[model samples]
Target: MTVPVADDWRPRLSPGLVLRHDRARETDVLLMPERIVVLHGQASTVLELCDGTRTVPDIVAVLAARFPRAPVGDDVGVFLERTRKEGWTR
Candidate 1:
């Protein structure tokens, strides 16, 4: 079953999952058991903030500040929801 991400939700990487930079590939990666998911674009940035310390709005605020002209609120919401469904974030 899929759960909808709430504005107050504080998302974090699931157990046994780690985010890291792959210098060889010059890209970020999501490391999980027997799996290596290559992260692209703002994925790494979004995942990095999913440390369970900040709520969805808090994260969106930070990203919005960093990228003033971008639609961070909607983008972050969609991204978080997708990641949650993929079992990447909890």
Candidate 2:
């Protein structure tokens, strides 16, 4: 993953993929062409916000609002970089 400077629109969930939260199963799932990704914790929250409309910095802002005490910007930025590299997001 390339290092981002917060201003770049680095990643969003791939358009072909589908993200769903199964309440009964208590899981966050990403459905791909050949496999499914079961996300947890921060991954779940981050992916839930990756609707192609939010940039990395925008995501960080949203998460920060939800988690006021945590240092969400850096962490979310790093997670987004990984997700972008992983091909789960574009």
Highest TM-score scorer: 1
Q: How close is candidate 2 to the true structure, as a TM-score?
A: 0.81
lDDT of 2 by residue, 1-90 (tens): 335645768567787788888776788888888888888777888888887788788888999999999888668877777887888877
Residues 1-90, candidate 1: write the lDDT tens digits: 333468789999999999999999999999999999999888999999999999999999999999999888778888889898899999
Tell me the spans in candidate 2 whose CA falls farther than 4 Å from its real position.
1-6
lDDT of 2: 0.79
lDDT of each: 0.91, 0.79
Residue-level lDDT for 89 in candidate 1: 93
